[model samples]
Target chain A: MSEADQGAVVDLLGVLAYAELTAFDRLAEDARMAPTLTGRAALARMAAAEITHHVRLTERLVELGADPSAAMAPFTSALDTFHESTRPSTWLEGLVKAYVGDGLAADFYREIAEFLPDPDRALVLEVLDDTGHADFAVREVRAAIAADRRLAGRLALWGRRLVGEAITRSQAVIAEHDRLADLIVTGTGDLAGIGRLIERITDAHTERMKALGLRP
Target chain B: MSEADQGAVVDLLGVLAYAELTAFDRLAEDARMAPTLTGRAALARMAAAEITHHVRLTERLVELGADPSAAMAPFTSALDTFHESTRPSTWLEGLVKAYVGDGLAADFYREIAEFLPDPDRALVLEVLDDTGHADFAVREVRAAIAADRRLAGRLALWGRRLVGEAITRSQAVIAEHDRLADLIVTGTGDLAGIGRLIERITDAHTERMKALGLRP
Candidate 1:
């Protein structure tokens, strides 16, 4: 990779690290709003995992001798805007946000991880939360929907809006970092493959919605 | 143990677990205010450890067949009040709060863990963040003081105020939960021992403050 590419990757990693750190914080606060102790604890555990990701990313940045704060600074405003705009107002809303928002972020990261250099790619892949956690969120959403059928529509809509906002903000991130976009395009081979990947993500999301008894 | 005693212990566990969970959240949020990425990530990692504590406590509560939420509910108001009243308005203030506040809480938990049953006691002991994390906070605070020696007096006073509020709120929690107080007193053998324990905690706090370049 060229010097500029390495700098860009470091920048991306910093943003991701800080984003994970802040996400953990926000989710922890949101856990207080949970209606059940079980729910609260579950969300809190999920939030805690972000710190682990943050630590790994920060360690890598340190090894690269980059100032994580400066590298992360450019993307902070965009990420902050995304979070502020999509702040969940209720306990259920928070859960949906965690489920849908994190799931999407993970999917995007999985794609982006392919674009990175050897050890970094592996590191990013390893840091993504396991399917067990994601499945837990899915199960909770499904159970809630089963208990109150009416919630399905509202939550499904909320999940859609969350994805919409995530995509929009992600585009903003990509636009601001052309090298990252170039890396993704080149790494994935073509736009068609990328589109197919998005379709798969959307399909999985729709399946999740259906599992929660909601129409896509 | 009698049924009521078991219930009380579960209650205590719930409160402690929830406290750890929320503390993890608050600390992670506070970490963002850190001046450096290394400092921020360090605190975030510390926050993650709290979840492990939460999980252990939650499992204990479940084993007792007690609802963790019900167990945690009674103390929520008091805990929230304490944090709200002590909310730090600046980055340094946040560090001081984490350093002083978490240090005191850890010391108190160490004393209280003695009253717990075998596995729970061991769990609590294992979950406490190591002195290294606390030492980092101490170094940060002391460095800030060394940079501006005049700031020492105000921060020392702030540290005292934090300890005072913590003590006041803790007393209120104990007063409200007679069973919890009895557990501590009985497990420790007498009121005098409990007093001595408090003294030890206070001395430790003073030492910590001194380490941070603040007067006891």
Candidate 2:
């Protein structure tokens, strides 16, 4: 890869690394809202899994001769802003955010992975794999919604809000990182290609919301 | 062991399990205070390690035919109170708490492990073994103290406060759990035995503080 390609790869991995770290922090904080000890433990396990992914991504950054913290620093504010704006006020809301919001982010990264070469592609795909807590969220949300049909409307709105915030932050990240934008454009073949990618992610987000008994 | 011994064991494991879970929560919260990404990740790893220990203890509870949540429920408030009272306000304070606070808890658990039967004894010791993040805390705290000699005074008092709160909470727990108190008394063979145990734990805490360049 050329120097420009290396820069793009670092930027991509850096955002993903910082995202995992922020998720770990947020999920752990959200665990406090859980009504049951079992629920809390489930969320804590999810948070722990994110930290494991973070360690891997940072190590990979070091191997690429980029300082992990410096690489991660640039994306911190954008990620923190995204989390801060969508902070969940309840346990169920937190679960939906973990499931719907993170699912959207994972889908976007997986789409971007297609634009990368060899090992980086493989590593990105691997870390983006589900952290095994999705089923728990689905079960809890579906049960809660089933018991009170009115909750569906409120949570559907929350789901939409999460996707909106996620998309806004992601666009800001790509806009600021010229190399990353070039890499995405080059991978997709044109500006329209990026548009197609967002459509696909949005479609997936709707499906995820439906899975949780929330209307898209 | 009789039925009373079994009950004591359950209570003991319950408190320890809850303690680990609370540590995981507090340590993850404290990670947010870290001044650097590396420091943040290090504290996160420590928090994740606590969850691992928690899983083990809870599983052990399950093996004994106890509901893990039920076993952990009884002591949550006491553990939560101990943490709430000593919440760290800064990164250095957080590091000292992780080292000095957690170190003191580990020492107490190790002492109690001796009174446990075979596998419980081994399991407690294994989980209490350093989570591989102690050296990170030691290094950070020592480096900070060296940079500003005055920091030593504040952190030293913090260490003392941690021990004082810990002792008070521990006594409350003992007073409430008659079976567990009886187990300790029986294991020690007398009241003086319990006194000796606390003295040994205190001395270890002092040595730990000295290692971090703080007064006991």
Q: A1-216, model 1: which lDDT tens digit per residue?
A: 788778767966877887887688678778878777677778878887887788788789888888777777788788889889998888777877887787778778877887788788888888885736666667877888888888888887888898899889988888888778787787778889889878877887777666556677
Write model 2 residue lDDT over B1-216, tens digit each, in one string.
789888888888888888988999999999998889999999999999999888999999999999989998889988888888999998998999999899999998888889989788999999999867899999999998888999999999999999999999999988998988888888888889889998999899989999999888
TM-score of 1: 0.89
Identify the CAPRI category of the predicted complex in candidate 2. Answer: medium
Most lDDT-accurate candidate:
2
Model 2 over residues A42-160: C-alpha lDDT tens digits?
A: 99989998999999999999999999999999999999999999999989999999999999999999999888997999999999998678999999999999899999999999999
Candidate maximizing DockQ: 2
Off by over 4 Å in 1: A1-8, A147-150, B1-8, B35-39, B129-131
C-alpha-based local distance difference test score of model 1: 0.80
The A-chain TM-scores of all the candidates are 0.92, 0.98
